[model samples]
Target: MHSVVKLADAKRSPKWTDSQTESGSDRRFSQHASDLVLRQVAKAYRIDGKRLPVLEDINLTVEPGQFVTIVGASGCGKSTLLRLISGLERDFDGEILVSGRNVTGPSLNRGLIFQDHRLFPWLNVEDNVALAFESRRIDPADKRRIIQEHLKLVGLTGFEKAFPYQLSGGMAQRAAIARALVNEPEILLLDEPLGAVDALTRLYLQNELQRIWTQKGVTMIMVTHDIDEALFLGDRVVVLQSRPGRVRRIIDVDLPHPRDREDRQIARLKKEILADLAGEH
Candidate 1:
């Protein structure tokens, strides 16, 4: 089981010595300090003047460069969990630590990709990616290079000038991925990023995402509904129970990367996972 840190003691948490860096007048933590820890995480919402709990006693830890996938039924607070981790939702009870530092709000260190591409309709591929660097003081030439490199990273080398309307669904999503990665965030949060694509495209993108994760070695926590996709890409699959979403079980995929879809172990795990989701344990 992963260790859980108490929220009250978050202020006394030890700082990661090697993860600190001086950037201008501010102290910035390196993207390399990507490990995430959640302790006693819980959330609820007010519905018709009554409180409805969504996630309860959620505790999880994701090591740096680890690919962890979350699978659960709809309305299981899967997306809400991602929102909390990404620092988009702060009104919750928990301590979310990234490299020992508490996550108070959205930071450039964490990147979020949604189910839709969410790219600007007017911006071309390269420009859409360049939007990520707009707030920084990077040189124009360096920024352009970074954009082009990320585009190439997602197999959009020749489509730099193409607009979102001109690209296929898969291509647009690839551009979104490129945009999310341009900053080289330590953790990439994906919420059903491939759910909007066709089956063949989704399969192809799964392999591509795995390749990207292997190449970048960035920590990834993806919320997916497809058990096969989750098993195929994740180092560990986190199965969550519905209603008040909670960790039901965490299964380790000991197989090496570039895993075979027809592997006997994978088949067995899939069967086991399906049974678990069906409450058949």
Candidate 2:
């Protein structure tokens, strides 16, 4: 299920403030949608010689370039699921496919963003973003150009020279986003990328993300604790239950871009979803 919303009216919960933000965000939301398929994926962890299943027989699909959010109680394998798909951890059962290709290892085609902005403190914004392209033997000039373009795409143009230490939480996260996009990964895996930010900054970053997704058309799978965030950003929001995590429900947010905060249907849906998550009748 999927719903389009008015992009503007969507709730912005930024985690930071006081930074010159982007001139524009890249959103490649073509009318033509695509999807990623996860088939019967299961995971287990080894602890003290015991095998503990973290996830079991899970299956889900995210339309190509669609923004999908997974929310559930902690220890439900949200991050573990992301790690498997990102190819960080391959010790799992079931097939993880992106665009019909089985994900065996981390490839330049897939990008992963973590809760912490993994920017190198020594490197400036531009360099950090450009580092993503270092695997290939490219001319310095080309790499530099790619970095500049991606920084601008993530709205961090002038801060190219700013070190991670000099940036606010939101700014650093934006820089991380810029780096993630530098390689032009077909799918992005976010493990609570915005969880560490403040309220205001998180709001702004949310809007920035929408703009980017709408422009880039990259398939995104985000794990979030905030139900509202999931509702606002995902075409389909998947709620999971604990104890061998399973999908409790999948709801399609049927709104249009430039979403309205006060839209009656949106508010009602949010309330209903919240209630359902709360185990309310």
Candidate 3:
């Protein structure tokens, strides 16, 4: 069960401040829609009395309202990096800051979605989404409105009572997305959210994800193996190298939204990213 401090309440909650005083930079806050800064971050695991490094020197700053996509080969720690930012793993070295404050643990301000739609098999769509609001203290009317709005945003408006198994793969994923959004998180971290669906449905959901991003104006960071998907959806693509994953390059997608898959720039960038991935072998 996930917990949340309502987006509006979080803004005013004294427990979480409105402003963050970074080491040397000017103060930043959630009103700016949340900015994520990671510096000198590294992670390792100990096995058989030996230390095994998984990621090294991962440094990035995602600005408010940006869609940053991360692509790399397996074992490159793309998902591990996402976990660090999500505050699910805190034994890492260095720092992860959200709006200038250290990310010590998971908060309602950051929502996470995985490849599998981890919906409760016993719960219907509305009930599963309603779980996000379990700890929120808002009025019932407001809670209902939030759930309805997010469902509509994900185009699952009429399937409010449908069970997860009853819906198509795409629809189930949409419900998962709605659950993530119902909290009104300022930053959404997705770990291959569309990986389980068929290719055609994956393409369609990319469009849906773009639309939702536009509607909510939240910062999004996603990890994927699909080069075309990365180019199609990201404002910027960060490529990583394997064997102690490290950043290789970050490519800017200057094209406007509803981007053309056949655009010359997209094609060129795709080739470049493919070459980069191949080089990691």
Candidate 4:
């Protein structure tokens, strides 16, 4: 995570707040649920025996089943922030609570998807997804059923026997998503999971992800560099400035589901975001 985020520069909240933010129109449900809170969280990377700050103090609240996107220039620590929330980094300074419990380490409750599919080349699609449930003590039949259902959930219903190499980039990533979700995580963390795919495939997966998230009711926080992607998929898009990345602005995408990227409103925000990123702020 040698990203551009420098922890020393992240602004922190003076006091940790416990009150949940009111359910915005973006939240699907009437009541609050699936909240992922980060309070003054900071992270630093160790490279060459030296400490480099990646993310400074960060505070955020993500409502249940909400699709939140974080966008920044490369190295602005967007991915590092996700890692901290995912408990991939223990050396950071901060408090992260998911649904009211402190996150000590990785849990089956938090599903993480990275840029690389990270599938086992030796395993088939069904087996790769089933691996997520390995530590659990569920029955074999139950596991198989879960795997089958999730494959369908990710639109990979008929590709059970396909291996990672056998599938296209988009399909493999979808399988990877099935694996992350097979465990039924409460929160989904996506770190540019579609970054490596071709443009057409990336666009297709983006829409598929929105449908999946909406149908499943799992909280989603995606980190990406594509401003259009962010505006297209996020309920609220958070913009970060580079060099010790900090939350510059949070925009509410009030449009309804199945958004059209070509919509005039989205196009307007896209230009504004691009302008802000270009130092026209």
TM-score of each: 0.88, 0.85, 0.88, 0.86
lDDT of 2 at 99: 65
How do the residues 118-144 of candidate 2 rate in per-residue lDDT, one tens digit apiece?
999988887788789778888889888
**Is 1 or 2 the stronger prediction by lDDT?**
1
Error of 4 at 36 (Å): 0.8
**Which residue pairs clash within candidate 3?**
none
Residues 58-128, candidate 4: write the lDDT tens digits: 88888666789999889899998888788887677878999889998888888899999999999999989
lDDT of 4 at 248: 80
Work out candidate 3's RMSD over C-alphas: 7.5
Give me the runs in candidate 2 sitting further than 4 Å from their true place: 1-34
TM-score of 2: 0.85
lDDT (Cα, tens digit) per residue for candidate 3, span 116-225: 99998899999999998887788999988988998998999899999999999889989999998888788999999999999999999998898777666678999999
Model 1 lDDT, residue 164, Cα: 99
Please state the error at residue 68 of candidate 2 in Å: 0.8
Q: Model 1, stretches more than 4 Å misplaced?
A: 1-33
